[model samples]
Target: MARASRVAALAIAVLFLCGCGTVANLETGYRQGWKNAVIYGGVRRDVQSAGQWIDHSWTWGKDLDIIQDIGTVVGVGLVGIDIPLSAVGDTLTLPVTVPIAIYNNSTNRASVSRKTDAAPPAAAVPVNEK
Candidate 1:
């Protein structure tokens, strides 16, 4: 019985350390945090700087991305002891997902190049023909 319980506890801990908490936090509260920062917090230089640091320019998407990433790190750190691994995986997913989210979430929904979009767009006309 004692060994069985210990195994169960270890399993739980491993699950917690797999970044589930970070992904949950991201899915649940990110939009609210973003709205609060942009709407209530307003434009502060510090906020803008953090925004630029994450996404390379001070658009709202970038600003909210900083908040999102920080929350992911802190949330996963609190819940997961193996934060280095979890943070690494979470960080990787964001840059790829976030840019696509920004592009798709826009009113225009225009197509944009993504880091993993790998395929180069076809030329309007073949170079040999031109």
Candidate 2:
């Protein structure tokens, strides 16, 4: 009876450890995926806005390569489980939230600047100000 109890306890412990490992892996993957998506979205918005800054005759093909490279780097990092996460119950959450917030801010700023530049100068300003 003693030996049987010890074996059962060891099995339960191993199962618990395995469960924790699985949760950790899932959480890390999810966070990394989210980060990659946010970064890529920001990069795309920035590239599009940059396109408007250049003359109509100029192309943005070369500039787009940089965005693609950023995406690749993010992809590699995610697949490698480079992003860490904290366990909360059964779910894993990102340990760092700053990157996502910064990316969102950058995207918003780029989009706003692009729209402002695209609008006619007179339309962008109030008639009373002029």
Candidate 3:
């Protein structure tokens, strides 16, 4: 039992250290999980991507071999484990991440507005007479 527990812990640590969706979200301004107040955005995003992959595999990969099928199943299983883990990470760090996401959004909007405001209006083109 202790061995099993230790193995599980090590697996989780490896997954966490390998940079899952939560890490990617942090690096990308938390864009994946910022929509939800509870911060399940990262999981949702990961699921969507996984769903797309599965959908594409079924739709486009009509002749997958045994090895390919096994690989897909394993990939999906890993994602299954990753989704909840990412959700937990996002939830745990919500206090810090939410504020950072808000700041990034605000700054992005402000910069866009500034650029638009600074741009001059286009002048009318003159008509060419024969």
Candidate 4:
């Protein structure tokens, strides 16, 4: 019974830790976080970057060799497993993330408007009255 309880606890711990997207998004602030969450946290981004890197690697080129293809498949499979976990996390955290995103948006817009107002107007072009 004690061993079974320990196993259950470990499983719960792993589930929480596997939510890489939620952690990454929350750390980077709302705007970027929101974007990351939308794009499957960092799953899509990581895969794309990895593919590009492999394509450019000396051992690999635009055409993936069998070994490289298998590696890519494995990497994608791991990321695929994380996708649903991240989606769940992102959904659960929406209440928090949404407010932060709104606040960041408003503040950025206010700052930009202030800067525009502070700048001097452009020189007016001379015109002849008919």
| Local accuracy of candidate 3 as per-residue lDDT tens digits, 34-102 | 433334556766777677666655544546765467657855864877777787777876887677668
Q: Quick one: how many clashes does candidate 2 have? A: 0
CA deviation > 4 Å runs, candidate 2 = 1-96, 118-130
Residue 107, candidate 2: alpha-carbon lDDT: 81
Pitting candidate 1 against candidate 2, the one with the higher TM-score is 1
Q: For residues 1-130, write the lDDT of model 1, one tens digit per residue.
A: 9999999998667555545434443443366543211211111222333344444323455347667667555544443443444454445456544654454466234434343467777878856753
Local accuracy of candidate 2 as per-residue lDDT tens digits, 53-123 = 34242435766766665555554443333222112212222333345557757887988888774545565
What are the candidates' C-alpha RMSDs?
Answer: 14.7, 17.0, 11.3, 8.2
State candidate 1's TM-score: 0.24
lDDT of 4 by residue, 1-130 (tens): 9999999998667558656656566656454544333334444444554466455443635565766766666556546665556666666667776776677678779888887746678789988899
Q: Give, for candidate 2, the lowest lDDT window spanning 10 residues.
A: 83-92
- In terms of lDDT, model 1 sits at 0.46
Estimate candidate 2's RMSD in Å.
Answer: 17.0
Clash count for candidate 1 is: 0
lDDT of each: 0.46, 0.45, 0.67, 0.61
- Which residue pairs show collisions in model 4? none
- Please provide TM-scores, in order, for all candidate models, with all chains considered together: 0.24, 0.22, 0.54, 0.52
Looking at candidate 2, what is the lDDT of residue 123? 50
Error of 1 at 102 (Å): 2.1
* Model 1: residues with Cα > 4 Å off, grouped in runs: 1-17, 29-82, 108-130
